[model samples]
Target: MGKTLDNVYKHQSLVYKYFLYVVSVALIVFFFPKGGKFKYEFQKGKPWQYENLYAPIDFSIHKTQQEVEEEQSTIRTNKTDYYTYSSTVVSEVRAEVSNGINTLFQTEIFTSSQRESLRNLSEEVLTDVYDHGIFQNMPQSRGTVVVKNNEAQPIAPNDYQNVELAKKAVTEYLSDANSYGTDRLSGIIRNNLKANLFYDNVLTESALNDELSKISYTRGEVDQGKLIISKGEIVENEDFKVLSSLRDEYESELWMGSNYYFILLGYTILVALVLIMLFLFLKRYRSDIFLNNNKVTFIFFNILLMVVATTLMVKHYENFVYMVPLCILPLVLKNFFDARLGLFVHVLTVLILGFVVPNSFEYIFLQIIAGIVTILTASELYKRANLFISVGQITLIYIVGYFAFHAIHEGNLDNIEWVLFGVFVLNGLLTLFAQPLIYMFEKIFGLVSDVSLLELSDTNSKLLKELSDKAPGTFHHSLQVANLAEAAANEIGANAMLVRVGALYHDIGKMENPTYFTENQITNVNPHDDLPPKESAKIIIDHVIKGIEIARKNNVPDRVIDFIRTHHGTTLVYYFFKKQQELDKDADPANFKYPGPVPFSKETAILMMSDAVEAASKSLKNPTYGIIDAFVEKIVKGQMQADQFLNANITLKEIEMVKKVLKQKLTNIYHLRVEYPE
Candidate 1:
């Protein structure tokens, strides 16, 4: 087991790990909602282009979403809602009223005989009111009174009220007595009587739910093998109902039986095919990325992340799928790599989602167009305004594609879902965050981007500022190298921003011992004259190492640090080395060479040549175009013979282009042409 674990860590196991990765991704995608796709695509108001359709199995016609919702609303409107009547409340209130009447009669305002008569009159009237069945006031003047043991009795709403009804009853009862005493008796009843009946919320809700459960959701059914619809039949309301039901029953039949495994297997194979195609493309063309596990993982991670996001949206938030920022994946990938890879991954992701999202054709079509727009427009992420413009274009494409598909499906735009357009706008706004996401990717993956390169190229940054303040001559030389390298990079379709930034910070180590280098020596009294030739050579070689350390300390990107390490390309300090050989013919040559893994990229290679040519141009006494041309050729040829650029992925033709660009730029700097008479 330990040996197996060790083998897994070895570089030779990369292929196995990649296989495991692909399998894991395929399995995850398989677990998502890969609903069984209908054999033919159909839309409302469009003709059925397939052969005559017949029911394959016995199934009931199902309702559309709108129909189901409307049926539910109608049932809720007509459903009998129950309310519980508390018998104990009526009895308790009757006793309280009797006691209140007795207490009122105890006052001196009533004599013994009068008190006795008043009690009799109140009791008789209250009894008549209680027999009427007090109930809660309800809308439409009606309510179902739920009694004990779940017996529901309907009653009028006016039954439950204050003592005014009781008082009226008492007034008629007292007609036989004197009218003068009846007025005084009604005042006493009004002051003491209060409402007793209330609605029981818990029982009402339970009973209402019970009634709702009894309502049948499936209204009607169709026999097995019934003819549902024929080919080329316009899907009117009734036809849509039959088709919607057929789809539901078909999906249900597949899910409940063993047939779904086949569907799942098909989904897995399809997703795996797309992923494998992507891997093959990368391995064949972008082999550098293919070999690096981290880069390959980064690309796959983004694709998987977007897939998971889309699947979740489709499953739970089908309506808000438009609100997802699907364009972000292509935007970020294009900024990091190229437009082709970005669009490729985006297409694969949307295709996987097509199986799950409702209206798969519309979803896939809109996202594909948006992804294309993102790739075409979102290139320079360093410019903040570029992302805004790109996002706007992506949003516009989404809107146009969505409406066009809607128009095709509906045969008109009058019923278009305008809310989805708002969602698309929100998606575009979210896409604007891709710039910050690129920064995060750069940090987490240790990858550099154009945005970071642009920030580094600024002259006021800490590292560049220090180089300028402490070693002004090296700083000026770096500026010239930047211009020369940028021009050359543009000529060869290289990363101009990266090459320019690299040229700017290439000689930062000279600030540590600025005077030791010839460019920074402002005095005739040279510091190197006081030291041995080997020691001087050591100082020159040490700058590359010191520059790396300083750059790391200051948080420079690894790509920028490449220029610092490879600008000299392991070449010997010829002046100091020759001087050392004169003193001791056996002096070690290794001590004079810069510690370098030579320029491994075109940009770094360009920086090396540009740095050499620009610094050499400074030493010419009688400068002319011919002198500049010869100087450029001599420096570039010498470096080529030393094989400095062999590992840098630069071709001979590209090197010649760089040479030509350097000569032109240096001649312009020196004003080598004949001066016009003033």
Candidate 2:
């Protein structure tokens, strides 16, 4: 069993790739709904393209989403209140009367007879206030139903009054008893009164929710075999509602039917077919990503992740599905790969989501257009402003697409759902965070994005800075090679940024023994001259190994490190080997060659040629334009004869273009331009 798994783990094999393709497709297909799909499509205010439609079963005509939401908001605003009557209000009134009488007797503000009359007036008025019920504000329209001893009594809207009004009644009762003490008596009575008719939140919420749930979701019913709409007839708002209800009823009935499992199987197969197309596309065109398990998994993971997010939002927060930031997928993929692959994956994801979301056509249409805009405007994403601009364009596309669809449906822009437009704007803002997401994926999946490459190419970066201070000459050589390679890569339609960054850090190993290499040696004493040929060749070859170590230690991406490993392309250090050969006829040449796997990509091949041509161009004495052109040809031609570029995915035509760029660049550097007369 272990051996069997070992064979499966070999990612480069055809069997391994096929296994991953099946597994990835299977996992994505599992997220699809088990309910059956409708055979025909319909939209509001559009002509019915299919034949006359009829309902096969009796189903309720559900209200539109907008109508249901509006009803819910109204219910929440005017919900009935459930009140628990506390006999505590009577006790509170008695306490207020007792405290008032005690204070009056202690202060002696009133004579004995007047205090006695005040106490009698206060008791009668307090009893009347408790009976009328001192409440907080006025009662709601549906009325507050007070519960006591399992009996519920409804209080009228006008029956409940504020505590101040209750105190005024007490003051009126006392005005005749003591003409001077009416206002003072009211103040003492009002301070002790507390509204005991407290709002019962638990019971109130339960009652409100019960009322909301009782609100019928469906207003009418359609009988079986009823003709819904005729062919070529425009679907009005009423007809659209009936059709949507029928769709929901059909799906719900199918879920409980005996053929439900078969429907699930069909959905699984459909999703799998879409995923299979993507797999074949990668296998045929993007085999570099296909051959690596991590990269292929990353792509499928992103697609599945986006689908899951869309599915959850559609199932729950249906109105806010547009705010899920679907465009972020294409923007991130485009930054890592190309626009074509990004758009392709995004289209597939949106299609899969279309199977589950409402108004499938509009959702798919808006997302695909936004994805295209994302790919077009998100180039050079290392610049923060480019992402911002791209997000703006994507949001604009979403808004325009939504408005156009709305105009078709309603025949006017009156009562547009402007909140959805705000959702698209929020989506655009969320997409700007894809840079950090890209960095996270790079860490988790061991992938490198263009943003990382751009940062690595900066001369002020830590590793580049160290290289400059330790080995200035090698750093200068690297910069020239970067310039030459970048131009050549652009000419050949290769990844210019990747090759430029790779060229900048290709010889970082030379920092370990800076003065041994002639480029970094500034002193008269030559270190290599004192050592034997084999020993000196070992020192030269060790830079490649040491450079790999340094790069890995500093967390350099492996893609850039490939240039360091393959720049020499199994070529011999001829200067030292020839010196040994002159001393002894049988000196082994293998000891002087750099260990290499050869270049496997156009960018790496361009680097190899540029590195060779730029280093050799320094040897030209009193160089002319023709001489520099020939010098570029000789070094590249020798490398071609050695078949150094055979393994790289580079064509002879592209190699010719690289040579043209190199000759022109070297001429500018060495051969002077004709001075124009003033």
Full-model lDDT for every candidate? 0.78, 0.85
**Using Cα atoms with residue i matched to residue i, what is each candidate's TM-score against the true structure?**
0.86, 0.85
Residue range 399-427, candidate 1, lDDT tens digits: 88887877776667776778888998999
- Of candidate 2, the 10-residue stretch with the lowest lDDT total is 176-185
Clashing pairs in 2: none
How far out, in Å, is residue 551 in model 1? Answer: 2.6
- Model 2 agreement with the true structure over 1-678: per-residue lDDT tens digits: 988887767634678567766776676666665567776799889999999999999999999777899999999888778766667776876787678778867876677777766677667767777664666655665657777656777777767767777767666766756555656667778778766666778998998889889888889889999999999999998988898889888888887867788777777788888888888889898888777778777888898788888777876788898889998899878878888999999998888888888789999888888888788888888888888888888888988898899999999998898888788888888888798999999999877888889889999999999999999999999999999999999988889999999999999999999999888988889998899988998999999999999999999989899999999989999999998998888998888899997898999999999999988887888887768778888898988897898888899999999999998898788756754669
What's the CA error at residue 627 for candidate 2, in Å? Answer: 1.0
Among all candidates shown, the one with the greatest lDDT: 2
Error of 2 at 664 (Å): 1.9
